[model samples]
Target: MDNHTTIAAYNLAKSAYANYGVDTDKVLETLDNISISLHCWQADDVGDFETKSSSMGGGIQVTGNYPGKANTIEEMRADLEKVLSLLPGKHKLNLHTIYGEFNGEAVDRDQIEVKHFQGWIDWAKKNNVGIDFNASCFSHPYAEDGFTLSSKNPEIRSFWIEHVKRCREISNEIGKQLGTPCIHNTWIPDGSKDTCVDRLGHRTLLKEALDEIFEVEYDTNYMKDAVESKLFGIGSESMVVGSYDFYLGYAIKNNKLICLDNGHFHPTEQVGDKISSVIQYVDEVLLHMTRGVRWDSDHVVTVNDESLLIAQEVIRSGALDRTHVGLDFFDASINRIGAYVTGCRASRKAFLFALLEPTELIKAHEDKGENFERMFLLEQLKTLPWGAVWDFYCLQQQTALDNEVIALVNDYEQAELLERGEVLV
Candidate 1:
């Protein structure tokens, strides 16, 4: 394909994807609805915590947890395929690869005994693919310190190193088999303050672990080059990849990439530097969505926030070409599709808002010493009228506001967004 076709391929792909999640019947209804942009599916959740009662992003914590529904591996994969077919070719997948237990006990990461991985790869191998690595580093209880959680003992650190090496191999194998890249969705369950945060001791150890993992082959035979990294699995204090400006320069120098997570950037307190954190190292944004109500875990985000600001930062950064926005959403209950739709819609709106935001914020930040941090979406929304912003920029052309109430609810799309916006897509 020539330059135009290559770009067209991406746009054609994007159109299908932009209206993802809504089913054929629902899709037409969605064109009638307006929130067609927010369409996705629930693929994986990594927390080992399970329960007798089922809930979104919770039940999967239990083993043998399919609830007499779609429990079998084949059955589960078929469920995945069924959902994909429903969306047609419009939507790209935010596939959360599973490292889940059947009932309760942790499934060995090294054991590729089952066909779950193979089945999904077989299905998505050639399509315009998108995926997320929602695996817990805690599955191997030995990672108590972290992936390379500063083990003093050579044996312990060696074990962790070997674990990473094994995972790399599995990742390479899977990526090669499917003709898709392996996304490194790192969530440090064992990470916390003084745990995996900013302490030089921990960062040094984490760096060592990272160096070791990168050095080790992602596969037994290094046929497939795995290009990936965890979005934010470090200390929550220093969790936001955009905030670590000092370290990011080093990461970029080393050819590593940052994968931004939606949940990890939450509460504002977490994502300090936002875009700048990954500007040097970011290759993709791993969209991790959940309800915002904290359950002492990464729950679903019921509302939107400064994430819009960050999305604009991403847009202005001119890194969209390098970005593959993958959602890591999990609803252990409520028919899976709910988790998918909620995440899909929210992320789309947030990004659309950012793209639509006037470039003046960016130029202003660049001109005066004013910080990009000062630019917030909600504040910008106050300036623009709802109709002008929504109808022209965000909503599908000629579509009425009643068609997609979410668009109205998310004022970022039309009013404030378009007047000063520059979202090319």
Candidate 2:
């Protein structure tokens, strides 16, 4: 907990890892370069400040009645400021189209433009962080039927196409202003609750709509496009128009980045294994780190085996430069700030654990056909002084070490969030 104790422990850890040919300093440096994008919706439970919807009509759901949820753009930004301060290194923020500032004026999805989000861009500039954008194709009147780009009606499909095009333009502007290429991700809740005979028809329309939406050329240096797929949703239990195969093939053909949401696949599918296979063919990929309990529940992430494997696959495959990692889980059941800090820290810890592994040693054994020895070394590396190294990293960052972060969150809730009472527009 103290500086001397932490320094001594780190020294011991450095020596222990040296025996395995591992460099603790190099691991800390590498971890510092990795920026995990924090999702903005987590602070507000997906309820945008601009809308007054009694119910979020999207197939997705954020089930919890937690107090102190952000109800205004100012509140959301303030909460995020606290979150960023609590985190280590630099990071980016993921923003949805609905989270724009319109000065309390009504702005429809179809009518959104760069002006609506200039405040966010300016905020990012002041904070010295990058911004990512997503088009809100759900929770609107147009998406009530669980379809957007794939809608049979020409008017409905065309509206969404225009909206996505504007979002891309906004993303390009954000990246141009921030000097970092923004990843513009697209996701639509288009599917059927029951088995439909028109599955092929929907996919066909979706492809045509996407082709039209991506017709305008934007500089890849400013922004890149990514398509996200989901297995199914609450109402769309039977079929999802943009299935994994559909987007995977589309991404390969169009040279676009494919987003792999951890909660979007079947229970048994290892998203980690898919990473190596995807990067071999695609130029780059985006990852939405989430936890799926039986299905795509979007619970807060933990330092579990799934996360460890995912981090290992990325590190072992040497795909860090090509992968854009971001947090995507939202749980209104717990403290909003707590959820953000917990998920982001868990991800960093996973990466840290993977970085501490004696990977080269294991790989050398495998190359020599010593399979059992490789497995034994991997199992043994799990019990090393990785925790001490992590503590040292936290100490160096001047952040709360271990469970101390919980106390910080609780103090903020009591001193600030609870006294705020009702949120104003």
lDDT tens readout by residue for model 1, 204-263? 665676576777545422222212323344343333222334245535655544544445
Q: Encode model 2's per-residue lDDT on 1-425: one tens digit a residue.
A: 78899999999999999999999999999999998889999998888756546457667788877778887888899999999888887789899998988786877888898999999999999998999999999888888888899999999999999999999999999999999989999998899999889999999999999999899979988999999999998888999999999999999999999999999999999999899899988999899999999999998989888888889999999998898889898887888999999899889999999898878888999999999999898888788888899889999999888758888999999987886674332
In model 1, state the lDDT of residue 100.
29
For candidate 2, give the lDDT: 0.90
Instruction: List the lowest-lDDT window of 10 residues for candidate 2.
Output: 49-58
Q: lDDT of model 2 at residue 315? A: 95
| Global lDDT of each candidate | 0.42, 0.90
Return the TM-score for candidate 2, rounded to 2 decimals: 0.97
Against the true structure, what is each candidate's TM-score? Answer: 0.57, 0.97
